[model samples]
Target chain A: MSAPFAKLPRWADYGLIPLINLFVAFIVAGLVVMLVGENPFRAAMILVEGAFGRGQNIAYTLYYATNFIFTGLAVAVAFHAGLFNIGGEGQAYIAGLGVAFVALSLDTVLPWYLTFPIAIVAAAGFGALWALIPAYLQAKRDSHVVITTIMFNYIAGSLMVYMLVDVIKPLGSMAPQTRPFEAGAQLPKLNWIIELFGAKIRSAPLNLSFILALIMAYLVWLLIWRTKLGYEIRTLGFSSKAARYAGISESRIIIITMLISGALAGMMALNPTMGDQHNVSLDFVSQAGFVGIAVALMGRSHPAGIIPAAILFGALYQGGAELAFEMPNISRDMIVIIQGLVILFAGALEHMFRPTIQTLFASLSPRSVGLAAAKKEGA
Target chain B: MDFLNALVLILDSTIRLSVPLLLACLAGLYSERAGVFDIGLEGKMLAGAFAGAAGAAVTGSAWLGLLCGILVSVGMALVHGFASITHRGNQIVSGVAINFIAAGSTIILGQAWFQQGGRTPALGAAQRFEAIELPGAAALRDVPLIGQIYSELISGHSLLTYFAFLMVPFTWWVLYRTRFGLRLRAVGENPAAVDTAGVSVAWLRYRAVICTGILTGIAGCYLSMVQNAGFVKDMTAGKGFIALAALIFAKWKPVNAMFACLLFGFLDAASIRLQGTPIMGVRVPVQLMQALPYILTVILLAGFIGKAIPPRAGGVPYVKER
Candidate 1:
């Protein structure tokens, strides 16, 4: 058969295509803004200014990005293993319980540094436990992980509500949350970082967790690219049949990969619960787990890519809040619309423009196209 | 007599609540049976609810509201089809995107246009679907148990509720008896065979997707116009997921789907009634009851009941071998 389409150059494949998709997504989001009778460019300008205009704004953006970084890493790990672990929302929320439990117990005696490591372990443990059942089911029972994970999300919501309302809420407390942790449990704010830039951070929740997120990103890179397990995961993701032929245990890989994914998702709780809220609130995760899917997709499931994508989303979240305050007509929900459009364009309809672009490139230089075809045949 | 009245009351609510789930389950049944898995039922229903409320409020006609909802929902379905069918994109990712789009855009547009903070004006009676009392219900009201069951549990509901129930049998007939039904099922199980038989797999799947849009639109219209009288933000809530769970619990069969939805609806209605009420001298947490449907589905999916195998070709785009 004739070559279906010309192969894209590395730069065009990795960089240009995603950029075009992002541009299309923004254009659609802008059209949505225009439909509501708002000027799209002004809204965009306000959004950008709100995200990066001040030191506090930048701090807030990073604060949001920290959560996305954790979640994005979670999704990317699973993507490498050919698994879709959408239960990150539930896992992270449940991990809050572990974090809160550790924080509540240790805050009375331990210092912030001591409590922090224990909280991370607790969070990762809970998240991994949450993912275990779905992983087991997918590996052993042949049940699809997607539906089960979605179900687990609802189950997690119910469990959290019960824990908050009936079991954990302090007596005589009207609200459904634990009493605030003592000072030892709180992560120190990264106000000094802003100060070093000759600007003051005013009430933004940017904290030590941002550094933790970056460290985790680096560790994730090491794990996926430098470790044997990472090689196995990538191999399995490429083709389970091939992995099986190579004598890899499919069930073991699936479960282990999902556990790692769940742990990363769980660590996301550390940001909001410890860094900012200082207590486990009902909406602490606040859909950051879902945001991870978009980040992972936009980043092409790489840590190198995820950090920047997470920051972009963080900007959207921070700026969207400002936009809501300034523009009465456009609420913060507009950011969610942009998010959905990004997922649709960047993730699902990624190849919508590929064929046309390929044809254009083929016509530009037939020699390169022929060379690429020959290379493919040789490979 | 008191116990019976309570039972009837819960059953009445059960039917009302089940209507949307039933319609949505059937909608999923059609699309999934045609090998196109749909996790976007929630999003479509939410969008439909908003469009239905807005359309009815604007034109002062419930019928026109339904038309608007159907049109919008169909538009979304076509997008899903384009991605999953044409581009061979991940079905779950496409579904997730649709849901987020619906969740975000409905509220954004609702706030922008109506200015009621992401809600349309409370609909007028003329713009709503009022319940219909079945014939002879008044005469049978004095007949005790039968009377209560007939008049209270079954008789009073909007036109859409009856249609939802009716669609079950109709759906069964369509799936089992019609030539199109055979082709649809065959295409889902093995698309290549149908393609070799000179039928376009894409066209058949598109038709199924459109049917899903229509049914889900009705479900949405029912939510806004019949059940609540106006649209609310995230009003569909997790009902779409419950319908999905019900679909799995039913193993994608039409008759079984109705019963599964009814079971879930009963759980919901009972939970509402059981709130703050001690059961056997113990206060049951409402959250447990709220989570029961999901937990039970997971259990069933794990093969505690029976395996729920989807259509053989589900979620995979038909790629002709070169």
Candidate 2:
């Protein structure tokens, strides 16, 4: 074998790799579809159409994308800071519960405008607090954030089940969920825009929550690329020792990064409660947090990349539901299989493809000069 | 007599619960000691449980099922080892992949094979592993205090329970007393040094992970064939993580891990007992009791347990320089 260090790819070469990775991923996805006895072309067409074939379908897809945006941004923020953040699920859970409490308690008395801001703030605050514990442990005692956050997710799940089943059960109902929010508490829909699509689109709940998600995405981008704090986060992410030499406090960065990630995760709850489902329900936020990991990975952990990645995932999710309805034999789980394969291929893409590309490029340019040398000589 | 009874009850519950955790923790100890972070323990356990139950249901022998469970889990461990050790993939991502596959595939297979709605058919009492009653323990039953403790605490668990306890000391001996143990530690701490000394770091880590798989299989089989007598979807529920915590909390020492498992098991038992019990003149919701173990784990891990250090190079894959 050659020198072990010789195989390592330079950091600058990572930019063009994602596009090739995505193309390879789609090829793999096609193979998977063929294995499942479906025509890849038909399946791909149907999937795209299901997401955007009709105006209402497009609206619903965007609605799903809104939640993914928040959670994906949450995971990306931590990924940028070198944190895995498996606890987005738990943070979102607590934040959702916080939103529910505020929505139910203040719905009757507070005006719609006042109640909406209060609910969003409460959700974000609760999420930040939920994340603070694991962050503190990791910073202070060197505890592994992955294990701690996962434990907290289980605890959060159980607590939510308990709250829904016993404490917060609706007064007159036996259902294992909270009561629906009052009319005043619901986020106002974009009714005027829906008039153009006629009666079909009016039924879907397209509210102000999607706008909030977009704004949050833009803000996250600014925070990650523009600010001094962002510089510290990225520096520490690349190398902790270098960040320390640069006089950035690692502990403070960890805490602040986690809090910001948690707050973004908290905002994800608004998509279900205030937009699509119109209330805090147990099934409303199923595995959105876990799916965020895939979103972040597919997006290459960038804010702008996250939007399209979220839309892709949202399309697949909606398409899967439609397939389940149309073909009962296939089951809804094929989407999970697709999601798993996408993640597997995408995560391994860099390791698998970088060397192959370098070798291919090396053969084409026989002098064996590196890419940087070639570019410098050309310049 | 009352005090002895309470002590016996606690001891019995502790042993019963701790066996699974202890086995899994020791398994984690081996894997981490060889520098592979085995977070797929829960998924492996679930796979083992499903395979074990299916094997027993078909073969009509619990022992055969136990062996089958170990074999299936070893397959999973091999996959994990190959992905992380051979392919040099991210250990955490590979572990997560195994977990997702296990979670979905097991339930799908169970539903298809058993027609039991994501659960295996329950085993009859005779088909399950029987508890061993020590000879002369019945005669000691008349002694009031010590007799109750002896009969209840030591004599009535399945043979696997006894083996689990024995493995703790055996592990300690192997980890500290044997040449393999030293090499294993060296590989985890500094694989480059081990490679320089002419030891195959990859082979050692592979063996360590395989051992973890076997132990995890036993824990899973014990849960399904002996303790609960059936399999359920995602039944291991984060016990693998709890065991990981115990492994860390004990500083990856066998004896310390034994006690940590016991402490966690006792909390689990106490949580069960606390349900439906009145506290402060009001009945407490059982969910709070159920959440106690996780809450305690979080608190303990959050700067309260002094400092728990992971093995250096714990999750890094070793590639031998030729």
Candidate 3:
């Protein structure tokens, strides 16, 4: 067989290909916008301005990115171990419950400093607990994590519905929600830190959680690249038989990786529940967990890659919300079509244009020319 | 008297609720059995529902609506085949993308055409598949013990529900008793062997996926034109996923998948019935019953009932060495 286009440069393989895919996705999305009777360039400008026009807008985009970072990391953690832990959504939902329970139970008793740390632990712990069942099932029972996680998402929804509607709704209120947490339970916004640097900052939902997400990203990098367990996880992913021969336990790695992934997913709850909403409400996790799949795919499951990929999606989401407000015809749901196109190109049809691009790159490179000539002579 | 009536009512709802699940479960079965795992059943169903509603509204005929629904679903299936079979893309990612597109496009188109908040116009009786009365319904109702259960719980269902029930047996027969079924099963387990036997693996999988699309189409039409009126935004909800869970819980067998779907339907009926009702001197939350089926599915998959092994060739793209 031909040699997979004679080995493209690292920059071409990692950066250029993804960029090309994104360009293709955007082009399709533009056509969709045109079909809806909007000028594609104008619509594109709207998205760009909405995401980065002002300090507050940038803050909002970053806030959204923070959620993606947590969830993308969660997905990436599992991807490394060759597990598709689609339970990130359910894990995050269930973890929100844990966060809500801690904040509700302890906000009055403890100070902000203590409460914040406890809530973070609560979120991660709950998320991990939620993920463990499926991990255990996959490891021991031969159950597919994909199916179990999907089921758990439904169960989580039902659980949340019960918690919000029947058990936690304030006695006098008809809304399906718990009472707001005490002031101490709320997270501080990032503007305080920005102001310390003597720059005027607009108030947005951007919070300390953004900083936490960054820290988590760094920690994930350390875990995946610098540690022994990481080595085991990567080995198992590459080849189970090889890993088994090397005395690396497949089941153990699957469980550990899923647990870490679940914890990271759970950390996503910190943004919407603790950082912004200040209450566990209906569908609070929304689609962040699902969006994480796209982020991880686009980022190629790397922490360094995930950061920028997360930011790009965050912009799309924030900008989509803006487009909904500006255009009367294109509603919020229509934005999903664009998101779907991006996902289709970035994930499903990710390599549709790869071979062509590889060939194009190879023909241009001087080394490939020499290699091709040498192969022809040998033939 | 009240307790018996409640029991009858619950059974009645259970039958209605299981129709979509049964069809979608069978759809998943067909695809997976042919080595093409399709989690896009939900997306296909959504598209079918929209097209059905729109077609019925335009033509004023339920029969025409059904055709439109099937066409839309088939289109979706073809797209899935192109991505997963031809391009060798990740099946789950393609499924998820289909879902996103279906979910978004349906709402967008609905809003554009109907201007009714992402919903089609409420269909008239002529544009819907109404219930069919079983023979001697009035005579059967007065019989002492089994009368109420027979007449109230089983009879007078919509035509689609009966079709869904009939499909269970038909699916079983086809899988076990037909030449095509053998080839389908073999392709799923060991495609290379079937390929060696001169059967095209890609063609078999494509055929199965297309069959899935057709079944899901009828399921979607049933939802819009029979169970309820019109196409609502995200009307399929998580039914497709639940159908998947049911499929797994049944160990990918046709008859068992039907039972699993029924069980889920019963759970849904029970939840609706038990809502706001006191249990053991305390009010039980409606969500408890809603969650029961999913919780049970997880337990079943976790090996409480038994292990569910998927087809050996499932999720792996067939790569032939040229």
Top DockQ model = 1
Better of 1 and 2 by TM-score: 1
Q: How do the residues A311-362 of candidate 1 rate in per-residue lDDT, one tens digit apiece? A: 9999999999999998999998998898899999998899898887777777
lDDT of 2: 0.79
Give the alpha carbon lDDT tens digit for every residue of A227-290 in model 3. Answer: 9999898988888999999999889999999999999999899888778888888888888898
TM-score of each: 0.98, 0.88, 0.95
For model 2 the local lDDT of residue B239 reads 82
What does DockQ give for each predicted structure?
0.89, 0.35, 0.73
| True lDDT of residue A89, candidate 3 | 91
Instruction: Specify the CAPRI tier of model 1.
Output: high
| DockQ, 0 to 1 scale, candidate 3 | 0.73
In terms of docking quality, model 3 is: medium
List candidate 3 stretches off by more than 4 Å.
Answer: A1-5, A192-202, A366-374, B138-141, B144-151, B279-283
Clashing pairs in 2: none
* Candidate 3 chain B least-lDDT 10 residues: B144-153
Taking chain B only, the TM-score of every model is 0.99, 0.94, 0.97
Interface RMSD (Å), each candidate?
0.6, 2.9, 1.2
Ranking 2 against 3 by DockQ, winner: 3
Off by over 4 Å in 2: A1-58, A161-167, A170-173, A189-202, A282-284, A325-330, A333-341, A348-350, A365-379, B1-7, B124-128, B137-143, B279-285, B319-322
